[model samples]
Target: MRVHVVGTGLIGTSLGLALTRHGDEVTLEDAIPTHAALARDLGAGRLPTAGEEPDPELVVVAAPPDVVARCVLGALVRFPEAAVTDVASVKGTVLAAVRAAGGDTTRYCGSHPMAGRERSGAVAGRHDLFDGRAWVLTPTPDTRPEVTARVAEVARATGAAVREVPPDVHDRAVAAVSHVPQLAASLVAARLEDLDEDAVALAGQGLRDVTRIAASDPHLWTQILAGNARAVRAVLTGLADDLTAVVAALAALEAGDDAPGARGTIARTIAAGNAGQARIPGKHGGASTVYETVRVLVPDEPGQLGRLFADVGEIGANIEEFHLDHGLGQDFGVAEVDVVPAAAAALAEGLAGRGWRIHG
Candidate 1:
């Protein structure tokens, strides 16, 4: 398939790279000529020449949310015979804008790949960005069934799982799962900005994990949040209510440990958070299974982590998750390996047999 990707940003360049890796011819374009040329130099795809035929089989608009509708509309009009899609995060807004502009709806489908890093631009693009991630398709009544399926092929080519959903439903779903999380992460990280250097020096993995997404591009996020304001606001309102309750409960409990119902309120709030966290799907999109940790002390040396991973694989025990805890000024750190409860003992025994120190 000949794919013309408009806007050689992270998503656009990643898709082009993925498609090209899968033996598809991809053409790259961007509003900024340098960006498109850089993406081409990075082997994402070739830049289309002047007066060249723009007969792309697929046209992917990867512009920011504010400009996505315009780009998609332009793509649809420029390549009337091609199937058009946008990789914008907000679907309902873009789709509505395109409809309002009187663009050809028959060939346009709104898609969002639920995959990205906190980084942006062509330099941050990876061929495996969409691998094992969900790519949602929002096809309207005017969208042809065959055109929708053709777009699904583009998603599948990047190793993404395809799911068809309504535009409104997609917007609401992402508001809860994506937009709210980014906002919450940013809010939490914002507190550290003015903290004392000594206070911030004691930060651990919990802070790092929670604030990772806070590093995302503010300009891009501003556009996304504004485009889907209604849905994002709804999510924020619910979160604010919960936060207020927690704050009140904590204040009451601090006044008196046995404050009537205050302790229960705090307990219930934490319990609810635990329940929600547990409901998150795990590897391969299956229910998250309870895993036991096998802590091992590893030297802070080159290939130490690699040696540990190789040893775990040798035991045939699949690691579900792993975390490395580095204490300040410590030469040796603890590696907590999480595996199925059944395999935990075997992994520990196997590592111990190989003379590796098992802390737990």
Candidate 2:
């Protein structure tokens, strides 16, 4: 398949790299000539030759959310025989804009690959970026079946799992799962900005996990949030209401220990979070299973982590989850290894027998 990727940003360049690696012919383009050259130089794909009118079977418009419609329209016009798709985060806005501009809806399908890094630009492109990730196809009624199939074919070529849904459903789903979480991460990280160095220094892995996506590009996120404003605001309104209740409960508890229903409210809030977290799919998108955690005290030195991993392999315990956390002012870190309930005891015993300290 000959694929033309426009906008040579992170997604576009990454798609080009992935497709090219999959043995498909990929052509690179961007609004900036230098950016396209950079992606090509990184082995993503070749650029168009001078005075050569290149033809592609599929055109991927990986432009930012705000200008995705315009780029998609241009691709549709420029390659009349090609199936067009855009990799913009928001789908409904792009679809609506394309329809309003009288673009070719039948030949167009909007898709969002549910994979990206916090970094932007062609330099951050990775060939394996979409591996095992969800590539959602939001095809409208007018979209031809072959058009959708072509997009899905290339998406799978990059090792992404293709999922089909309506454009409106895609917008609402991402608003909850992706957009709102970004805002939450950014808001939580913002609190650390005004804190004292000592307070910030006391941060743990939990804080780091919650605020990991806070480093996302602000300008790009601004456009995404703005494009999906209605759905995002709806989710945020519910979140705000829940936060209000929590604050009220905290205020009551601050006034007195025996405040009516205050403890119940807080407990319920935490319990609700626990339930939600447990519902998240386990490895390989399998059903969620409760795993028993075996904590080990790891010495702060090189090769300690590698040795621990090798020991776990020798112990025949399959680790389901692993986290390393450092204690404040401590010379050692805690390694939390989660395994099946039946394997946890053996893992703990085996590590202890190997001269490792097993923490409770």
Candidate with the greatest lDDT versus the true structure: 2
Q: RMSD, each candidate, Å? A: 1.9, 1.7
Worst 10 residues of 1 by lDDT: 257-266
- Measured on C-alpha atoms, candidate 1 has an lDDT of 0.92
* Number of colliding residue pairs in each model: 0, 0
The digit string of per-residue lDDT tens for model 2 on 1-360 reads: 999999898999999999999999999988889999999999999998998777999999998788899999999989999999999999989998899999999999999999998788999999999999999999999999999999999999999999999999999988888899999999999999999998999898889999999998899999999999999999999989889999999999999988999888889889988987888788877889889999999999999999999999999999999999888889999999999999999999999999999997
TM-score (C-alpha) between model 2 and the true structure: 0.95
Report the Cα lDDT for residue 234, model 2: 95
Clashing pairs in 1: none
List runs of model 2 lying over 4 Å from the truth: 255-258
- Candidate 1: segments with Cα more than 4 A from true spot: 255-258
Q: Which candidate should be chosen as best, given TM-score against the real structure?
A: 2
Error of 1 at 118 (Å): 3.8
Per-residue CA lDDT of model 1 for 54-149, tens digit only, reads: 679889999878889989988888898999999999998888888999999999989999998878899999999999999999999999988898
Worst 10 residues of 2 by lDDT: 276-285
